[model samples]
Target chain A: MWLAKNKDEREFTGGKTDWEAAARIAEQCSGFEPDDEDEQTADEAVSCYNCRYRRWTVKSFSCLLPT
Target chain B: MEIFVGIDDSRQLDGYKAGETASLLTRAIEDKGWGKSKIPSRHRLYPNPVIGYKKHNTARSFSADIDEQYLNPFITYACTMIKSNVASGCNAGLAVVVPERMVNRDDLISYAYRVKEEQVSKEECMQLAQCPGIYLFELSGDGRGVIGALAAAGLRLTGNDGQFRGKLKLGHEEYYVATVKEIIDKTYVQQVKSMDLVRLEDDETVRMGEKVKVVLLDNLYTLMVFPTDLENPKWQTSTTHMLRMF
Candidate 1:
């Protein structure tokens, strides 16, 4: 599920702390390239949480890259 | 003299991370013999949906020690690197400051904290950059990056915001094992504490996690640790999962 679907404000709706959901989404995501190591927040190696395209918001991050 | 460098908006149209530009710039600073640098630190800023490029809104900064004479050349070198590689048609901003000579301004610190929670104006960045000892330069594109660069320099001056770039690098890729004392003795890590900020005793052994890293707290490079499941290695180095709270 997604929260705000607006191009910029779209969030995963799983909230900011959902590590498993992020990793699962990333495993199959063709665009899920890892972000800079310094900025990665997730425990799993490959996750949208660590992607270079997830623009962070106050409560959750918005996926700025197209699916 | 010690020099502080702040950079932001280096992300390319393709998905290059901002920290990559920062770490490369710092590496060049060291390679050029200007001086060795402390690890680049990432200072996050307000994330507005409509503003800025890249995935996350953050800036990177580092401090290096060099002879005062080489300062100009070093800045030139850095600016050239950003233009040629990092910024490439992007609005990259750069700020260099000498803490000792810069007029101490609580306003600068306030400005940094403000950007973390809300949008800031380029006018504010320009005004703050005018303070003595502060030098601000735009490397490419629309120059909106000046706001973030100034904010990052402010964050660096405070020494309290952000996490160091790269891992602290302990034992090996799998896992590292050492006493809390050994970590501090061998590495620049000042202390091995827990998530709650409790400093572990030197004698306690911690199974340092793979790619273990440190956080800046109380203006010190800190290695925060936590407990493992009913094990002899009573404490464990903080993980990327844990340090993200910074």
Candidate 2:
């Protein structure tokens, strides 16, 4: 699930700890690129929390990939 | 004398990583016969938007046992390396701390925790730098990186924060299973423990996943594991998400 903050910005509705949701969403997203090894935080190899385009926000994280 | 070298680099989105720079510094120290360096660790800083970091807000640092006479030369070389490697439109900071010579070690440790939980400024770091045995430098740009660099040294001194920079490769497959003693023999890991901080016995077995990582715990390279099956009490290496707190 995602919340559209603007024309090109969106945030993950699952917040930071929703590993299953983040992984599910990333699996379908074409722009999901794995971040640096040190930055990745998810056990799943492919997850939004591990995506290079995801920018961490105070409450959750936002997708930086152009929508 | 033993010293900790801390570095933080704020670079372009696609520029070189600060961790790589930290690793290079360790190699340089050995190549120049300056000292024997330990593995560099990555310390996480407060992620507030005010910091304006490119991605994750983190700094890298490592400890070294060196000849006291070479201190100045090492510092000068580090400064030059960081200045040249920093990317355009970015800032980099370097800090060299000798704990034994510090005026008050507690003050630096407290400041380090504050940087992790709250907004810290360059002025605060500058004030702390006045203490003996602590040196801070701003290599490029606006020099905000000094905040993280100083904090990184403090965290490293605590010996409880941060994870080592790279993974521990013990096998060629997706997973590797070994006894606690065997794991220690194959890698730099000095201790193996469960999630609850209970140290596993030498004969205890562990299943290491694809990415085996170690954290700086109790001043040693510690590998943490969780039970794969409570009934059988099988241990497995902690995953990336599990080690995020470090």
Best by lDDT: 2
Chain B TM per candidate, please? 0.87, 0.96
- i-RMSD per candidate, Å: 2.3, 1.8
TM-score (0 to 1) for chain A, all models? 0.85, 0.94
User: What lDDT tens digits, residue by residue, belong to model 1 across residues B98-202?
Assistant: 877776768778888898788788888888888887888887777777788878877877877788877777675466678888888998988777888788888
Where does candidate 1 chain B have its weakest 10-residue lDDT segment?
Answer: B9-18
Candidate 2 clashes: the total is 0
**DockQ of each candidate, alpha-carbon based:** 0.63, 0.57
Residue B77 in candidate 1 has what lDDT? 81
True lDDT of residue B230, candidate 1: 47
lDDT of 2 by residue, B155-198 (tens): 99999888986678887766677889999998999999888999
Pairs clashing within candidate 1: B193-B225
Clashing residue pairs in all predictions, respectively, total 1, 0
lDDT of 2 by residue, A1-67 (tens): 8899777778788878999999999999998899888877888999998888887766687787976
The candidate that wins on TM-score is 2
